[model samples]
Target: MRIRPITRDEITELVDDLWLPFAGEMGDIDEYDALAEDVDVRAEALDYRRTQLDDDETQTFVAVSDDELVGYTTVAYSESPPVFARDSGAKVKDLYVAPEARGEGLGTSLLERAHEWGRDRGCARISLSVHARNDAARSCYESMGYETRYVKMDRPL
Candidate 1:
């Protein structure tokens, strides 16, 4: 259980596996409206996420077990936290532990690493968005001492 920097090869390997399912669990009404405007906005965002991982600004980590990629988390700053927090904050852009990997403290380890990554950047705090419907993840985050500071409002725009 080492927390380390994500290499290019690791990013490419994890992109297809982690991005879309995470994207599908967004604020529904907002995603729905955006789909009406252009069906590919979510796709574009996933692409952008991968690109950000490739860029210098974003950082990521993975939980490797027995030489297999099992879990991952990403952190990004320099414009963060959805404006709910001030600048110089870091956002947990992604966190996922495969079904078999959950409950082993991997998520917590990944989160701790992400926050450490934030602190290393001189960030004031770390933040992330969880799906309103994902009670399990919400609970996990809450147990980890993260509170719901902002509710992403959703209505037909």
Candidate 2:
């Protein structure tokens, strides 16, 4: 297995397939907010990512095994919002590893690459959001030195 920046051709061939498993993992988090059957998640995500990938502030890295894309991470540097008391930093929007690829350290490799990317751009920090129910990902992030910044509690009432 190897890790590298995603090539344009690979994006065209693998983006949709990659989204499926990623979506499936998130689906396990909560049925109430799961992706709708008709949503075409990958198609929309692909279009959005393609545009973002053209910008200098965004970077995506992919993990390949046996010539197939097994996982990927996407991160972007952003200016602090005017109304928010936050510093400019890199935010990791997606980190997906196929189920079969989970134990091989691809996720860690991708995350480390993201940290390097952020540090290279002089970012103060790199951050990400994991669903509260997603214990595995949360554990992984915590193990990597990430700490809870805020707890988002939701109520249907």
Predicted model with the maximum lDDT: 2
| Residue-wise C-alpha lDDT for candidate 2, range 1-157, written one tens digit per residue | 7888887777765567686667776887787656777877777867876786788999889988889999999989988878987678999989998888888778889999999999898888899988988888988899899999988888888
Runs in model 2 lying further than 4 Å from the true structure: 82-87
CA-lDDT, candidates in order = 0.74, 0.84
Per-candidate TM vs. native?
Answer: 0.76, 0.88
Q: Which candidate is the best by TM-score?
A: 2
What would the C-alpha RMSD of candidate 1 be, to one decimal place? Answer: 4.3
In candidate 2, the residue pairs with backbone N, CA or C atoms under 3 Å apart (3 or more residues apart, or in different chains) clash, namely none
What tens digits encode model 1's per-residue C-alpha lDDT throughout 1-157? 6667766666555655554544444434335522335466556755666687677768878888877677888888866558565658888887988778778888899999999988988888788987776788888899989987889886666
- Stretches of candidate 1 off by over 4 Å are 20-50, 79-87
Task: Score residue 142 of candidate 2 by CA lDDT.
Answer: 94
Report how far off residue 68 is in candidate 2 (Å): 1.0
What's model 2's lDDT at 100? 84
lDDT of 1 at 57: 65
Worst 10 residues of 2 by lDDT: 12-21
